[model samples]
Target: MFIDRAVIEVRSGKGGDGAIAFRREKYVDKGGPSGGNGGRGASIYFRANSCINTLFNFRHGITIIGKDGEKGGTKLKYGKYAEDVYVDVPVGTVIYEEKDHKFIGDLNEDGKIVKVVKGGRGGKGNACFKSSTNRVPRIAENGEPGETKRIILELKLLADVGLVGFPSVGKSTLLSVVSAARPEIADYPFTTLIPNLGVVSSKGGESFVMADLPGLIKGAHLGKGLGLTFLRHIERCRLIVHVIDMGFSGRDPYQDYLDINNELKQYGFGLSDRKQILVASKMDEEGAEERLSEFKSKVNEEIIPISALTDDGIDLLIYKCVELLKTLPFFPLYDSEEEILDHKVYTLEDEEPEFYIKRPESHLFVITGDKIEKYYKMTNISTDEGMMKLITHLRKIGVDDELARMGAKDGDLVQLCDFEFEYFE
Candidate 1:
């Protein structure tokens, strides 16, 4: 039930259509245009909630849609704007666009909100186009279309310290003894399939969140034994508590320590460089002291020996974590400037072309672009005035000139989206 990743579809609401009406009062000699403008569409937003800990609510591949605006009323009344939609996700959730895998935003704190997609703008009424040169305009625009997108949500547990080691190494046992989290513990490997979180309060009144991640094997970086599924969870951890099983008869404690460090180095994300506190578990077991001595001799760093069952050295471990946390700063998930820039949104205003021209056939020319398509969708082409407006926009944007340069002749076909028309120069 602890789902951390999900793919969902989201859509924003469309604007309401404009109303075309005229005054027919008995006392009025000449009635003017009294059309009303359409209402605005709803926008979609994602909010972070501290009470939620997983992405399970969004695992069912649901499609979320925002509310549409109300239609415009008669007597020059403007339509009502739609209410925005908000989605609640767990803290530390990262969103990305599914099509190109572009990073949208990171919700790492509680109550943080991000607007993922914007709704379409409402169209104008015939009264909006009334001018002295062309009084009593009869054209009314249609409503704009909504935006649809498929996004991916990934959850990374936000913890001050992370418990990492091989399976059955006392990581979960230590967590249960120090905090209220009761993780499934067993004698076999991979007993803790999912990550577990607990809050540990030191004797000095200092508290910090700790996470017990799943076990890791030799080839973990190469997709062996849980693989990258759980390794990503370690990226946000500020401190790593490496627990080594000094009592395991078949395994060498020093070798285990070296192997786990190698996996962290290979996984990248600056995990190997992260601050660590070495813990030797099962100190009460027979022959554990001898192995601990050997591990201490091989490594110059200090290691704390603790027995979870007997509560020996647990206070020292907790105090050491709190002491070190005061000096250590939070590590960013993205370290390099290039990585940060890649996640940002940038606009290429003057560099990119407005539209592209493609000729699939000698008699047909296809025009495609984001701006052109948007205008085509919002224009009300049923009336002559609307059609003339679109034609004027196309000419102003150099579409007509470009077609003429391409040897387009009269009666030739021009395509924009699904609509096709004959060119007349």
Candidate 2:
């Protein structure tokens, strides 16, 4: 079960609400607000694990949620913060945060980790609203909400050189002889379903990775045989080793070479900027030399002929590849992803907190405002003492003054978000 891509939901924990309480000691001269603030929420993180190669585990679990923060308590005791959740993925994974189509972190290097979702901030307690004018304040804030997002994770195999040619052209055969990788090989087309990686080393201890990707057909780019699957795997390659079958047995060998290169060019990096080597396979066939000679004149590119079956010209191919790799610049194969540096921050002048709640919605006072919501989260509403602390806290915050300015009379019906009460001091 070699999974290459996966989509999952990630959520950070919400912050805990603040506690609203007053100092009610027997000998205290005057008891003031003494509520504690709520705890911070847990954040969601993505870690890169070199041991993992596939996204098979993610398939089973689509949603990953973090633990919520503990609520604040009385006696000015702050709530406990929750631990963050870490989701481990294999290296070379690229993630795209779907909301804004923004590219996230590229987990190319081993042990690279990234924080995906941010946790909500904890609310303030009533004690924070204390002031000289008002001794008793009655307002506690609720905890902030954590961030949630859905993203796509794709795996790009790291390979130094990629083998490109038509199906059943002996790309896998050449790989078997040169490296320890034993890919499924047969005489039929599309025999190798998955891309196979092999390590080729020289006598001087020079080594490079090779990928025997699925074959490319004439319409591969347009959703033909192996189609986009083959093209995507080779995107990271520093070089394209074009394997041409001069002794096609029936099909036009030259035409086959043209079609494959056309597909590569059409798919664009246009990878034409990268290094390429032309190699004629199945050289043991009769008249292969004749066709090879004619093919060179038509194509006029550097061609290395080889018989992968008997290991003929295999060494030369390796030598040529090692030589080419030496001169080429080292480019990361996980080039599909670009590092993202900034996050989207929304800001609007005079933007009011506006949200609607239906009536008969469980005594819900539809309140509006960022400051108010944050205050509520920071408030601890568990105890009556805490509630008093909340009210006194709110009063000190000039909520009472604001309400008076809004034209409130004695015994007037007052409305606040999530809670409603009769107005009278």
Candidate 3:
């Protein structure tokens, strides 16, 4: 079973909580805060492995979670940092965020790696807050939360040449003859469901990779038959080898060539403009020569006529492909500058507001934002000093001023996260 696409959920580890212990040595007097800071959480990364060819390992709706960091220890002993996790995927795998389909990364080369999510920073201990004016601070911060996301993985086979045509066009047979690849072949259409790759070597000691892509039908760009699923695999091909069935009586050889080219044009990605080599397959058939003559008259490009069963013209086809590949350049997956820019993920660090206030009712007010929520999660609010410190920080950040400007009166309910308190002043 060849699987090329999969969706999985990944989560980065959470940072360890800070300790709030104090020294109790007999010789020491008034031992200040001795708590240690927490360690950083584990990160998640995706790496490309040339050995793997499919995403079948991740097809079972797998959920990958990074290891959490160890908690801080007493006596000023810091917690241990969690190890990062790396996942191996096939080369030419493209990842996208599931929610918005935003492009994440493309692993087109072997050993290529991309960090999908970074671990959270560790929390500070009570000793971090101790100063000349303040001693024996009892506050300690909690661990930072981890990040979770659903991502989609798509695999596009990388090859120098891609063989494309309608079903039963002797594409698989040609690949098996020219190279070691033995793709499934049958008399019916859509027999080859998955793409097969082979390394073809010419007699001149030149070699190149060839892919036998799945069959394409009319309206394939619109997802009619085996659709865009296999068409995307063609994006990585440097040269397209269009195989036409000269022997088949069900469809006209000339019209077959036209329909397939139309599908490639409609699919975009500069596929229509890419370099191509036309081949007439099944030349040993009774009316194959007649069909090839007609196809050549209708089309201006040179077509190599080959019978895969007899190995006739196969050597010429291989030599032509090897010679042509030496001159053709590799096409980038994204064609335009705008398309490349669209894949980049931008962060609004300074442009976004620090916090926002929402009034759900006449007597209720809610404060919510990423920055404020992060501070709320880290603050140790069990002690009076910790609670006072949080309140002072909130006031310093202009939360109090914003509420006052919004006509918030004393005794009105003010909520931050799950905690609700009465507005004062």
lDDT of each: 0.88, 0.79, 0.89
Clash numbers, per candidate: 0, 28, 0
Clashing pairs in 3: none
Q: Which of 1 and 3 is ahead in TM-score?
A: 1
The C-alpha local distance difference test score for the whole of candidate 1 amounts to: 0.88
Compare the candidates by lDDT and give the number of the best one.
Answer: 3
**Model 1 alpha-carbon miss at residue 35, Å:** 2.7
Error of 3 at 288 (Å): 4.7
Estimated TM-score for each candidate? 0.85, 0.77, 0.84
Measured on C-alpha atoms, candidate 2 has an lDDT of 0.79
lDDT of 3 by residue, 1-425 (tens): 66778999999998888888898899998787888988888999999999988899999979999887777778889989899999999999999999999778899889999888888777788888788888988888877877898999988778899999998898888999999998898888888888889999999999999999889999999999999988988998999999999995579998999999999999988899999999999999998998889888899999999999899999999999988888998776775433565344568774667789999998899999988898888787887778988899889999999999999999999999987889999
User: What is candidate 2's lDDT per residue for 1-425, written digit by digit as tens?
Assistant: 66888888989988887666788999998899887888888898888889988898777549888877877777778888989888889987888887776677877778888898988777767787788976776667778888788998889877889999999888999899899999999989999899999999876688999999999999888879989887988887878898998775577888998898789877764465678888899999888999899888888788888998777888888998999888886455333344333566566964654322222333322345666665554555665645776678678766666656655556665455566676675
TM-score of 1: 0.85
Worst 10 residues of 2 by lDDT: 355-364
**Positional deviation of residue 255's Cα in model 1 after best superposition, in angstroms:** 4.9
Off by over 4 Å in 2: 97-102, 249-254, 326-425
